[model samples]
Target: MDLAQRIQKMITPTIKDQGYEIVRVQITGAKHPRLQIMAERADGTCIDVEDCATISRSISAVLDVEDPIEGEFTLEVSSPGIDRPLTRLQDYQTWAGFDVKIELKTGIDGRKRYLGRLLGLDEEQRILIECEEDEPHTLAFEDVQRAKLMLTDELIAAAATEQTK
Candidate 1:
């Protein structure tokens, strides 16, 4: 229903047809909005510049016909990168055991942010994070406003291992 969701819906098929999965779609700025589309290879390989260009072209074609935006906007296509935003529930599972920073839509016990090791999702699909405290914290997935992997040596090594595979 929102701009990003609309854009994602419009371009998802095209992107999937090209063997890519969209990671996230975001529209920012007021004067000249920027449409940022983060995507990854469906095969789990690293995305390259050529991949970005191909996705950009495909998305541009769809947007050109749909004319979704009221005014001029910039379309950017890129990979999720090493420190990627966890936009989907699957992302949490995929990146489990890594350090992450999660921000909630509303504070819990006067705390709005959490930094800890991701323990993946629980049976109810709620997020499980092991903070510095004694017990792990359980958060509702829907309550998470934004979350991203923390850049660390372990993450970098994991990314390298994945790329080499």
Candidate 2:
């Protein structure tokens, strides 16, 4: 597995045990490497600064022991913002009815990009999206290259409400 994937696999259990779930793991920069870990409560609650610091310390300890990186690197922990990538399968279900942009690994009907309201996962695990005025689009989960929520006034309002709760 890649570094990010390996780190995710190694530290996910510990993070979950701490009452949080890993949203995404990314390593950026070459000379000054940075490990960006986006995390949130499993219950879909907003994570506060204290929670970020807590997770950072816990993850730092694990990374220190593992020594996954050859050189020094900076670690950052934060909550996934309102416009977050739809990484997990549950994300699609939870954020259904929201506008989203999805890119497929292999083109579907000579197109790889799609923008529409999320329709969530179908019974067969395909991602359903209501695109255009016609029938909703069904895509294989494995075919998704990238997917993220579009920032809109409704999304902003929903995020504010979620943060307050």
Winning candidate number (lDDT)? 1
Tens digits of per-residue lDDT for model 2 on 97-145? 8999999999977989999999999999889999887788999877999
Cα RMSD for candidates in order: 0.9, 1.3
Model 2 misses residue 43 by how many Å?
Answer: 0.7
Candidate 1, pairs of clashing residues: none
Residue-level lDDT for 41 in candidate 1: 96
lDDT of 2: 0.92
Kindly give the stretch of ten consecutive residues in candidate 2 with the minimal lDDT sum.
156-165
Candidate 1 lDDT over residue span 82-147, tens digit each: 999999998888889999999999999999999999999999888999998658999988899999
lDDT of 1 at 107: 98
Each prediction's number of clashing residue pairs:
0, 0
Query: What TM-score would you give candidate 2 relative to the actual structure?
Result: 0.94
lDDT of each: 0.93, 0.92
